[model samples]
Target: MGGTNDAADGTYALRAVDPLIGELLAGLPALLLVGPRAVGKTTTAHRFARSELRLDYPPTAQAVAVDPDAVLRELDEPVLIDEWQVAPAVLGAVKRAVDQAPHPGRFLVTGSVRGDLDSPTWPGTGRLVRVNMYGLTVAELLGRAPREPFLDRVAAQGVEHLPTPLERPDLRGYVELALRSGFPEAALELPADLRERWLDSYLDQLLTRDLAMIGGQRDPDRVRRYLEALALHTAGVVEHQAVFRAADLSRATADAYDHLLRNLLVAEAVPAWHSSRLKRLVRTPKRYLIEPALVASVLRLDTNSILQDALLLGRLLDTFVMAQLRAELPLCRSRPRLFHLRQADGRREIDLIAELSGRRTVAIEVKAGAPGTGDARHLAWLRDELGDEFVGGVILHTGQLAYSLGDRLTAAPISTLWA
Candidate 1:
């Protein structure tokens, strides 16, 4: 799309991962790359812009602020606005500029949270196309190293056959992914103590800065507890009442806290996949960590701790599946809506139902380690129950090998779908 070279920005020089960057950069009028904090949104955006407009004096207040229109006029083309949600009012101005000039690649905007997650209004709508940026993928982890085994699979068979087979076990890659999480800074660094500090401060900033914007007035310590509660229960069906009970707060207060947490990008709730009126299907949705690392940080659970705690292990696996599904959807050039499935007889349940275009359904069940055929039994039951609606199934696990448990279902390592 855009003819700009990667050298347009020095930051790109250091970025080894993100195979989708070139495609994402040239997509639409305005490209909004939204992801959790420290996921390289600002770094990637600045690199895409190649240059940035620095403000000598930071504005004192967002409200009663200077007119962004006049200020943006002085900036160069293809402006990279870092932390746009910090001052979202400027986005409407950017929208107007793009509409008037009609440039394909003129502005790059990055936000940790959707500007209107609480209010439910993204200021720049038709003006910008949105893409998600997640933690470093295995491809990114390998950098320029000859294509990894998994990538070779994707290259040969295409992504459709991702679960078709598996070959080798790169334990080093698994360790790096587990230890590093998804944040770029930690992904590059190895020390646990340093990562601990980075995660602590990052969580603190989220509570103070981002949480405050969405109407959280509780004590920071208490808010931190609420986050920990959410982390412990990551990727499980949301029980607003459970959150309230844990924090010793009223229902209204707990609801407000959930909204605030989402607004800050600390968490997200995934809805159930029920297109029809199945009264037995769960109406309540599941919640997941925006980044898997937060769950580890909140639980104080590293790789070893994660393996030791059975319950925590399950949650971590679910969180990883969610992240992989979200990140890989973009690569496939498809927007996959992830949801859990449940049936009336209590006979069927699917951890993840990835509904692709033309009603193609890919069912998945996440497990802490190598999963058995029973994992896909629910999937088979679901397929039989839903008749033609249910498609093939997959059991994502911690195992090194990928193979079929039966005819309809297959098992794949969580690492296989890295980015």
Candidate 2:
């Protein structure tokens, strides 16, 4: 395993997913690590790779493009193919090689853009197991091992068992952390001005070069406007019409752009929770950029700007919490599904829900201020509705301590996520 100080050079970090990747590679013929650009996919792959074939290099790509099988045959075992999407035919060669041997740890492939989205027939249906990677979570940055999903733990063991955090960040501090982002360079190395410029360049490349490589042809300016609009609505149920008008995009173009962003793994949608036992529930998915830094960069927000606006701070906090939870999902033993809950009449809502096995759930609410009993009202209501299936509820706030609000519900500091 990589050491905890892996990010000293601002290129790699010991990710929570690293152990899982190692375990998977021992039995699987090929493993594909997929995430946004500059999220340390290549650096992680290098840890276990004995030899490498960088498909992004022109000569390597051209040679593989001509006869992928022959080129692949020449590499040593456990080869790393960086940016394998540059030569799509190499996937076919990999499929054939694995078919002949069916051995473990043959290849490690990394991709910034998903190649299957544009392929007519995916060559890696069974041969390659694709793992979802994300930016650095707080626990990862703190050099902690991968966390067992806190929500799942609460569901099984009650909220009274919540631990106290050693470090507490005030509201302004949390805002600054959100803006710092999870990208290794932006979060751990770059200064304020340089971080902003780095994030801006990332967006520019995504809008121009990355999109074109994925067969998307749209005006970069228009795409930027659309992205800014989404950033404004991050962590909320999107109002498509309002976003379209704000970006001056037609409905069709807006839909296409949305699909394009999701395909690139830059955005995500958390589906609404619904059940046959419940009626009049809202089903619209809540949308969020994969990381808070992307939203802050696109909207050009600073610490003072977010701190002064309560509504904006709340949304960004939700985004931040969601990112942490998503990063921990792979480490959970239960592997619970995540969702948001709302009523059609807007009478009750929950910021996030983790549905464990057997349909049981742990409901969560996010509050920007120090939490009080009033903050868990919606959680209480959901607890009453679901009874045993609703194991517990929690209100995550910027406070310094954890305490019970009511039966089966508690208010805990958001820092507990990393604790």
Candidate 3:
């Protein structure tokens, strides 16, 4: 129930990005942690910050709004500027500070919304290095370092090298994990009913306060309906027309809502993978609600409900797998890019693909139940198509066993994500 890497104060959980933050601090003049609100960005930044300038505080925000440079100059080195977006002028101040000294670890800024939305020209373009922060991943919840990306390891060493999982969740267990919600307060601290309320409140705040902060003025009811529609199609190649029709939104309003959701970090798109070697591949990106918990919350789905709907269960599982993979991305040495692959004819499809260095790829398929050789047929075909460019293929499933499906292919339990 408690995080393994809780800070001395017992209020913070050491995250997978903690080491990356330290590594970046040693050289970067400024570091910006960007993510959804209440995702623990402020808590994480507090760990390294010596002096604090919380722009969320009204007086502080007013001072920064009036004269950002003066407010910035008064703060000590390695200052934390929480909710810098509240007073967007601080970006120019931070930029100026970095230009004058060019010192590492001088500023640590946190923002709930995307930084670029407030300004026509971003002042921190070169001075600040942005690092994405997401909700607590299962690895972080368990207090595991996840020092190396599991997928990257599979790409490099093949599936034979996968560690035997210490814990393998059954189908029901996996469903619970998906519903656990990665938000620290929801996943770690709250009861089920309270957690549901917390999630609902989180979405409410996002639609009202957060949307207004980003200059998005729209009907909350319409936005919520749109969000619910998107939730139904989570982890699938989105059909814009169908979604808009379901939400009763016109094209222009739907696009605006889409932009707002993305800027708020509530929705994400995993782009379709395309290669010159392959033809008739679908280029539509798969849309997700950023985390499985949000999808479950938006749909008002419980464990029993999800278990009853096979299609919904599979999509949620995919979303769950994606959340874990996105968390592990920062740790990957090769810095792979994630994409979903599908052919126009629907003859071939890969749930996820990690394109490693040199355009080589590691393909993955997510299955709700134990996967057999047939489940890996698509992966094997991709392997054969790409030859040496294909590092390996894996069928991640709810099965308890890890075994070989064929050459350069294996079926491993989904728990290996955090193992």
Candidate 4:
């Protein structure tokens, strides 16, 4: 994590944009990096290691185990082992290595899926630091342009001082991202249709291969239907009963499917933020698809229809804004906890709650068009309810301007949220 890892020299290096890099660089004696499929957990680990032993790859499992003393014995530094979850048994080996020589930044472990050990396993609690990695942020994708500094400027000058001018991503970029999805390699290499094919194949593999080993349900098709249903219901509060009806699944089956989605890191539920002693705050959490483009594609909601359709447009904007906030979380040295604010009278609702460090919070409303008083009505209500604890309220919309509605509200452009 400190010096550098030369093991990355010969590997295919995509632009290293993971904001978690700095945290992962400061590895404990043992650590685990977990994420959904194709989030670049393995490559990032290898790049951070001084040397690496890829246990999940061919031949190395035998090489590392049979000659553990030979493989890591002479090595006096951190060595990353990719996809370590595939061989959970080797964790005990790594644990013993740590016991013998407990050096910080010694073992960097990466895993895509989570599972249980058949036998009693070593608990490397304080010895390991856990981190989550995800797809490229818009900041990372913008390269070295003025757009690259959008969020940085907002952070420095405060939302009120943020510049109102910036060029936005055109329809082409939006279409490409929607069709291609966010698996780094597939996104970078393949054509749109081909990338869609790859995404479909990846989904199939997760369902047929990875999910089966989760050991609960024998049938994965049900899981597939539940996922599709969840995707369609993106950016809304989670209701298992509604999902049961939509997917034609039993209540128990729906619950199990939801658990599997979480276990697989395929979906996320954002809990409501109602710590107010006020008796009227809504406590039910909202659910969002982890990736915006995936939800758009699953719902076949490409193009400006997302801007024109009321319900679909709202969900799309909400999900995309959530993605932007998530991209900024690691950069701010915090975990992004998503939330929604609602009242019992159905009179007020804020779409996003960005909880930052020191309990400083920002309430954001997602909109499809220009920012207006109406767009920020709910945001203003939330600020009134939460008081000075509110960092500021923002209305994220499709417009190119970053104008302020008032002293407390800024209409932020979605493309510039992380510009």
Return the clash pairs for model 4, or none: 1-25, 150-419
Query: Which should have the higher TM-score, number 2 or number 3?
Result: 3
Cα lDDT tens digits, model 3, 58-136, are 9999998899999888778789998888888888899898999998989999988883654557888888888888888
lDDT of 2 by residue, 319-358 (tens): 9999989877876776688999999999888999898888
Query: Candidate 3: minimum summed lDDT over ten consecutive residues — where?
Result: 1-10
Poorly placed runs, candidate 4 (over 4 Å): 1-27, 62-76, 116-122, 144-157, 170-179, 297-308, 334-336
- For every model shown, what is its TM-score relative to the native structure? 0.84, 0.95, 0.96, 0.85
lDDT of model 1 at position 385: 57
Clashing pairs in 1: none
Better of 1 and 3 by TM-score: 3
Residue pairs clashing in model 3 are none
Report clashes for each candidate as comma-separated counts.
0, 0, 0, 2
Give candidate 3's error at residue 275 in angstroms. 0.9
Error of 1 at 171 (Å): 9.8
The residue-level lDDT of candidate 3 at 298 comes to 91
Local distance difference test, per candidate? 0.65, 0.84, 0.85, 0.65
